[model samples]
Target chain A: MGGSLNINHLLFLGHGALWTIGLSVIALVGGGLAGFLVALGRVSPSRTLRLLAATYVQLIQGTPLLVIMFLSFFGLAAIGFNISPLAAAGASMTIFVAAYLGEIWRGCIEAVPRPQWEAAEGLALSRSQRMVKVILPQAIRIATPPTVGFMVQIVKNTSLASVVGFVELTRSGQIINNSMFEPFLIYSIIAVVYFSLCYPLSRLSRRLERTALQKKPALA
Target chain B: MGLELDFSVVLDRWRSLLDGATLTLQLAFIAVVCGGIIGVFGAIGRRGGNPLVERLCGAYVEGIRNTPLLVQIFLVYFGLSSLGLKFSAFTVAAVALTINVGAYTTEIMRAGFDSIVKGQIEAAEGLGLSKAQIYWHVIIWPGIERVYPALTSQFVLLMLASSVTSQISAEELTAVANYIQSETYRSFETYIVVALIYVALSFVMRFGFWLLSLALFPRRRRLGTPL
Candidate 1:
């Protein structure tokens, strides 16, 4: 308990940082897959589907990710699901990220120029073909910068997984602090690690946004 | 395993939930007002002529934006005590939230500020308006009007984020749910109820903001057009 910060503690933090990345990847992939469907649903021709997707986004957006974590972890356990912390954290993150990414992607999808959609229609393309060959390509270009920006959010939000006892970067710091009694120092290190991870993505997102903006005038 | 849903048990503690929701709203209110003030100044400092102030403001925004709020809350919660400052959990929660939201708000406010065309400010000056009058008539009000929607949404998000203060045991809505569930052994029912309450609160906040917007922007209200 009396020992100061050392290699083992730093090593533990490194391990936790790895998990933070792992959990973020899980969220991005799972959320991306689900968010794609949600984006599709939002833009779908079916009124019911669009309404349903919108409702899901609103509901999830309104509730805090922390509450979702609790509901998935302890709440599910009480109801007899007995989920592991990793599974619960991953599931929660996926649900939370899907709602946000879905909205972002929806905006991207909608941002596709009206003439592009009309052109696809004029080309006698089927609805699926139009989406696959035309609309999505444009949308992907519009989506890239925001998608990268949202990745920073996904990484930051992954810290909430620590509340569910997921042993991510923040939780590991808590554990070290429990023994070393150095909350500020440990948490400062943790914050720095998170900053290192997120700042690059933030910069990349901004750069992509600038390039996207430059390309816009040419396309127009 | 059999799944049975019973909300009645959770509903029995509605009074406590109400109290918690009230506290959540209070925390959100304080943070919004305080963070918003910080945001305005931070935005100004970023765009202002002083290179040092601009860089410092930029660093603050970037540092806050990149790190997780949980870590920031911990930093405030524990970092303060380590320095021998005594404060309540609620105070700590509010301060952390204010700091967190201020960064995002600064970015949004800066966008709002940037939307003001230079010609308008010059025109105000050509009309011989004082600096304070120019700022109010040409800058601040118009800037806020342009970004009202974004600003309100950010505030609503702040309200939702106030739930994180529960981690510090601030006795907000989420923390209250934690306590009730632990006592009642109705964790599922409790969180479900709490989540719905949050949804309701968000709607309430949105409606309130809409009403405020209507009153604040008479031109938009009269013309029925977005600024």
Candidate 2:
């Protein structure tokens, strides 16, 4: 009840900041893989696969990530999965990120000109080959800006993991505040730390978007 | 351990869930309206001739956009009390959500404003329209219409994000689920039901926005296309 902010507190926060980065990496990689599949499913020729993917996106997009975290952490524990807070937070972030990234990538894939698809088909390429050889190379460029932008979302959303007791940046702030009894000062620091982590990515995403727009005329 | 899914226990607490859902909607409604207003002014300020106003607006947008809402909520929830200003959890939650969503709304609204071509403004001026008239008809209305879909999606996302307010104990639907699950010891069932309720709420919000768009943008309605 009578503690002041000190070096120890800053060190604790630095440690938590590292975990935040680690968890974000886990979510980005895992969610990127799952989201790629979801994107493919959305663009698939099979009607059933398209519907399945659409439903998944709808459900996850509709539900809040906080609820998903609670569901994975406590719901799974109740059903005997009994995973750690890190696992639960990681899985929830992956599921939530997948829905949004899948939608983003789907738009990217579809943004490839219709004529290009016809040309690939005219060249006697299979669907997979068309995707790999002709479509994806172009889609990747279009996907870069938004994907980077969504990374900012992923970084900020990791704060919600503290609810399940994951010792990330936010949780570390809470822990320190528990001792310091200084909410405003502590949370202000936490917000600054988060801003430092996110602002660069936001600038990068904007730069990428500008470059992408500038290149569009050349491509067309 | 064997898993036995039970819905009946959670269903018994439907009244609480309904009240929570109502509060959730109420919070979202207030934030959307207030945030929309802030967004309008913010967009104007950012694009205005005043450099100080533009820089302040820019900072506000960037600061809020780059930070997590949960921390912002905490800052608001405790920041007020520390200043010896007393407010309810609901008020704090609403204020925080409004502030958070306002930044996003500003960005979206600014994009809308930017999409207004210089030719349109020049044409309006050439037609002898007053500055106020030009700002209203040529600038604000069309700008909003251009960004209506993005604004709609942002409001829906704001609704989903209201769940984070439960951490400050605002007694929203998610908070209600936390309570019910603790009481019934049916965490899985309670969250599943709450999740479905949230999904329903999002659908309802989206539908409401669509209807509003129809009423607001008669041109869109007539042409059957979004501006």
Candidate 3:
């Protein structure tokens, strides 16, 4: 029996690629909002909040994303709630990305020089006002490069959503392979698609990192 | 109906779980060691080899870095099989993991190499050391010593990533979890147990790396300063 690759398969993969991009966006926004809270909690003056946030990061970082995906997919259903695959994948990515992005943002936040904090305090600004007006603005500048770098990770990770039955690029490739029996070509195409999506962000991250390095001397 | 969890069934398969964990560790160990070797040479190539070699190394690192490990695994697995090369899943997983992690290690090691000041190499040359001696003493050892922490964490991440090999039916921890959960119908319990095992494994690996660094880099241990 002979089976051939066709335009229909390419269109299916194209649709899947869109879903992949869609899932990555969902993870980015959802994870970004939650991770922001985590970053703040990590740097919070309250001892208990700091400890809880640190614990959350440790627990999530210690566990693999695959397990988290599985838990959200099967565990929620097991607990008597019918969970959709997209919801499970998105929720798991949110939880997973929040941990990593929280850690990265924490580093960026802390990288804001000590003198800036002191100057803000010297200005008689309230703690909230100081953070909003001084610390966060500087931290955002430091955070941009790494945050863009993490976007590549988020995009690559959306492939894992395929495991829980979301019809993303990788899963669509698998579906096509099941019918066409052409694993190498289809998977290579999938890899190229991912590379195209991720390489730009990687380049941007590297460029930003370089500029950040260059900006340090000017700042000083 | 309320949720009730029972891990007893999963817990009863502790021996199989242990075997799977051991396999995961073994797979990770092979990948790290092999990848480290490739990385050191690759770093050197990128840093000092001919222009073509440097370009090739750069391409390899960028290519691997920009793709998901899942697809890479599929490509390697099918690519090899389609080429009429028959290998076991375990071997293929190890090969793919080594290749995947090697790209990352190359980048890290290249950074380490860049941080090796030119003056250090000149000093080694001033001492009339041979090329091999200068490379070993002036460059790689210290470069690695400085980047030990980064290297350790990378290897730990590699270990965690080894779970992905389960998709290829390489009987690692995650694959075992899949089987157990399917058999017992306690998916949550199985994955929770597997997750805890992974956490424990990472901690063990981190500790082991610390011990190893202490042994390998006497300067760090004695002087309490990075190289």
Among all candidates shown, the one with the greatest lDDT:
2
TM-score of chain B of 1: 0.97
How many clashes in each candidate? 0, 0, 0
Cα deviation at A104, candidate 3, in Å, is 0.5
TM-score of each: 0.99, 0.99, 0.98
DockQ score of candidate 3?
Answer: 0.81
Per-residue lDDT of model 2, residues A1-220, tens digit only: 8668889999999999999999999999999999999999999999999999999999999999999999999998887889999999999999999999999999999999998999999999999999999999999999999999999999999999999999999999999999879899999999999999999999999999999887794544
Q: Per-candidate interface C-alpha RMSD?
A: 0.8, 0.6, 0.9
Instruction: For candidate 1, give the lDDT.
Output: 0.94
Q: Write the per-residue lDDT of candidate 2 for residues B83-196, one digit (tens) a residue.
A: 999999999999999999999999999999989999999999999999889888998889999999899999999999999999999999999999999899899999999999
Q: Return the TM-scores of chain A for each candidate in numbered order.
A: 0.98, 0.98, 0.97
Query: What count of clashes does model 1 give?
Result: 0
Per-residue CA lDDT of model 3 for A36-146, tens digit only, reads: 999999999999999999999988888878888888898667667779999999999999999999999999889888888999999999999988999899899999999
For the second chain, the TM-scores of the candidates in order are 0.97, 0.98, 0.98
TM-score (C-alpha, index-matched) for candidate 3: 0.98
Give the lowest summed-lDDT range of ten residues in model 2 chain A. Answer: A211-220
